[model samples]
Target: MKEKIESKLREKFPNAILEVNDFRGDLTFLVDKNSIVEICKFLRDDEELSFDLLVDLCGVDRAKRKDRFEVVYHIVSLKNRYRVRLKVRVDEKDCVVDSVTSVYPTANWHERETYDMFGITFRNHPDLRRMYMPEEFEYYPLRKDFPLMGIPGSLQLPKR
Candidate 1:
């Protein structure tokens, strides 16, 4: 099944797939960021693939790497009972990626939360805003560089 999926992806988008891995039955693909939306659309629309469920979408802070961030997507084909993990590397300087909301509506809240916590923006998101933090807050709390003590006086506390 993994071989079939990889072959199809290669045939459709030759250079878009950077790497493929299968570890302990987990299929993973590291793909080009530029073609992510198209890739996702194909995954869902392809009759043989039919990855209908977007299980999770997340932002990872790889603090010390040249590409300091990664956007990961986990999708499952309910009909085929197979799962795949897709990853796209994102540099800190350019922390935006194309949204998958059009393919999977559930990505809406996940993208919002990732933006709120890790400060990775989702391009073309219907409503992209901080989920937990105030609109005016400057720091991303979940960032690796965020101070352990919290940003002093960043959030106003109401008097008791």
Candidate 2:
């Protein structure tokens, strides 16, 4: 299954995929961030692959790496009973990527959550807002640089 998916992706988008890994029977692909939406659409619409389910979408903080942020998408093919993980690495300077809500509507909330927690923006998201944080909150809590004890003065109390 991994081989088939890899072959299909390579055939479709040569030089677009950055890396491929097989760990514990799971296939993970690191793809160009600019082509994420196209890649995801192909995975879902392809006849042989049929990755129709978007199980999860999240972000990772790789502060030490040259590309310090990574957006991960876990997709499953109910028809084929297989799963694959797609990753797009974004540089901290440009922590934004094309939204997959057009390809997978389920990504709406997931993208919001990722944005709320990691400060990774999804361009063209219909209603991009913080899902878990207050509208006034200014910091992304999940980033490596966020203080473990939380930000000071973030919470305000009513004046007496």
Candidate 3:
């Protein structure tokens, strides 16, 4: 079943460079960021693999690794009764990936949360504003190098 699905995906998405891995029960394929939209379109529109649900989209910070961030897209095929994960690695300095909101409108809030927490920008996202973070936050707190302590005495809490 997995082989057939993979073959269909490869045929539909010619530019999608992927590394298939079936570790234990988890099924995932690491793909290039540039081909994300096309791959998603194929998944959702293909009659055989009608992945109608975009379950989730998330960002992971791999600070120690060369590829600093990875964006994970989870989709469920209602017709095929299968699930798949697509991952794309992006560097810290240029952590920009194509938005899937056009393919899946439910991805709006999820993408916003990812952008808020990890500073992974989704290019062409219609409403890419901070979701869970204070608007005044100058930097992303979830990053490894973010300061743990408060700023030096600018607004100290009255000797408490």
Off by over 4 Å in 3: 147-160
Candidate 2 residue lDDT tens string, 1-160: 8889999999999988999998998889999999999999999999988999999999999989999999999999999999999999999899899999999999999999999999999999999999998999999999999998888899687899
In candidate 3, what are the lDDT values of residues 56-78, reduced to their tens digit? 89988888999999999999988
lDDT of 1: 0.94
Q: How many residue pairs clash in each candidate?
A: 0, 0, 0
- Cα lDDT tens digits, model 1, 93-154, are 99889999998999999999999999999899999999998999999998899988898999
lDDT of each: 0.94, 0.94, 0.85
lDDT of 2 at 104: 97
Instruction: Name the top TM-score candidate.
Output: 2
TM-score of predicted structure 2? 0.96
* RMSD of every prediction: 1.1, 1.1, 2.7
